[model samples]
Target: MRKSRYIAKEVLSLFAILVIAPCFAAAQGSEQSDKEVKQMIQTQFERMYEKGIQNLSDRIVLTGGVKPFAVVSDTGDNVKAIRIRQAEEMPPEIALEVLRRSLIALVKKGKIGATAIFYTADNPNKKSNADKVLVVEMEHIFGPTLAQLVPFTIKNGKASYGEQVVVDMEKQIFNIKVDEESAE
Candidate 1:
């Protein structure tokens, strides 16, 4: 009877360990995944900011006032995208210029192979919901080339595309259409 009790206790201990091991491993796995995701997001944001500032320091400086920027990140099972949006109100032109410079800097650094930038220019009037959004798609050939452009007009929070603007950035010359896209 003593021998049976010893065997039964050993079996219960083994069973408890077997059941808890998986739970402990799963908890560790979750922590590791969280750390990896956070690192990836931080790395991406740092790359964008460092490359942008390094290449376009003169163009990206905030001169008029302090414009706060918010780093927005989205991650899912299949897709992830990060956006640096203006948190505080600023001139739409400045915001667009900053975004354009950052895009160019990223392209020059060979950071983006093929990417699309969807940017919004908020209305300064603050009277109506008439923000402008511009989509610039780029492709990597020998370098980043402006593959496509989709200009949109937002009225009452509705977006309507006007025309498709296409330009080859490799040519090193293109007319900036900020006025055409800004919320005027």
Candidate 2:
């Protein structure tokens, strides 16, 4: 009976190691993949910024009071030259701050969910690689409020700024035009 018990313990230990080893390997691989994706996003942002600035300078017409709304994505890419319509009476800085703060707050609230995909190195059932989605929520204060921002997507490690648009404060209604032409 003692011999049987000992054999049973050995079997269980072997099983535990077999199950745990793969998980540990997978976690390490995931961390490395995440780092790689972040680097790629940074590179993409740099390239986009250079292109966006030149484009904005060439084509954007800023009305006297209109300020360029810095379009920031979840991936930390800031696309410039977005003209936001503001009330001539309201301070431009205040208007810009309002829009920026709103976006930052929404992101931190996890309103935007983003994911990243990676190929698995040793799983046949899961295909060559798999996708890992990370929902990042930032908790910080810019001025008077706690701001939260989440990445929009895992493919580019960036957030999509599609829903947020600059509006005319004088109209009393949230009606605004998105500068889609210059956005891309």
Candidate 3:
């Protein structure tokens, strides 16, 4: 047989689906066969970073907090938000758990790609002059499992967002093992 070749993205997606998804999908979204969606996520995260964080910050300041929500990219320009049946009384951690599981299911089925999940948070770990924070977790099959914490304080009906704190994360979601695949 001629030597086999695998583009980096293809290999990454394969590993993301077979190995990474099962372990990390709980923390983030998983792989999709759609390269366009994966590429969009890889390239558009900076834009997503700006818009998603700011939108949630503004809303959370007004409503006290926002529910667990997500945005999924279907293609380069085709993006949609995910709305879940959230209980008003649901604990914040539990609510985010529900959303994470739901998004992972969608990822396994390849219905979407490059998910960004946001939740309202109160972390005792950091005191940034704010009790409430916006937590955003982004996952791309072709890139890293990334997260950010945007802390903010509200006064006089306006929200003052603090410097965004980067959360250290893993990147094997797209890691691939070509020989391992053939062996299996």
Candidate 4:
């Protein structure tokens, strides 16, 4: 009887370890995955910002398609008759960078003001593709403006947070809408 009880105890200990070990490993893996995704997003944002600041022509090309509410140049503000020619070809990544810079510029110039925004991952909508795209919805500090920046979904591993924006991988576009409510 004593021998049987000892054997049963050993078996139960082994079973518990087998069951708990996988859960522990999975938790560690989940944490690591989150870290990697965050790192990728930060790197991509930094790279895009750097590239945009380096070349103004890139910005022009990117925002050329969108309607500009306010224009700021080295010479002066509100340069009338500014036209952006559509290039024969534009890479998706370059377009995305340009759009981002133009919006930042507008914000800096006080053309658009927002307190907070909501952002979500639109494309892939799966755990695997969670890191693929981020949709940002901007909440205006005041009323919305007529100036609509081109809705761009970030591909090539870019992340963003805002409101009412759909990041569609299949379409390769970020669909954005403005909300008056602050989503801080």
lDDT of each: 0.36, 0.29, 0.59, 0.30
Any idea what lDDT model 1 has?
Answer: 0.36
Off by over 4 Å in 1: 1-79, 85-88, 97-112, 120-133, 137-144, 155-157, 170-184
Cα-lDDT of candidate 2: 0.29
lDDT of 1 by residue, 1-184 (tens): 1111222111112233335545754877767644543444333333333332233223222231123221211221111233346623546557645655654454444333223333333333344333432333332222333533343453444344445556665422122232233231
User: Highest TM-score among the candidates is held by which one?
Assistant: 3
Candidate 4 lDDT by residue in tens digits, 1-184 = 1111222111112233335445754777767644543443333232322222233223333543222222221111111221233311444445444444454544444443321111222344343323323232222222222211122343444323222232222211112333322222
Q: Where does candidate 4 clash, by residue pair?
A: 118-162, 118-163, 119-162, 136-162, 136-163, 137-162, 137-163, 152-174, 153-174
Q: Roughly what TM-score does model 1 have, to 2 decimal places?
A: 0.31
Please give the RMSD to the true structure for each candidate, in Å.
Answer: 21.0, 23.7, 12.7, 23.9
- Write candidate 2's Cα lDDT for 74-174 as tens digits: 32232333334562244644654554444444344532211111111111223322222111111111111111111122224322221212211221101
Off by over 4 Å in 3: 1-42, 50-58, 75-77, 87-89, 170-184
Clashes of each: 0, 16, 0, 9
Give candidate 4 misplaced runs (Cα > 4 Å). 1-27, 57-84, 87-172, 175-184
Model 3 has a clash total of 0
Tens-digit per-residue lDDT, 109-143, candidate 3: 55555677777778555645788877778776555
Lowest lDDT sum, 10 consecutive residues, model 3, at: 1-10
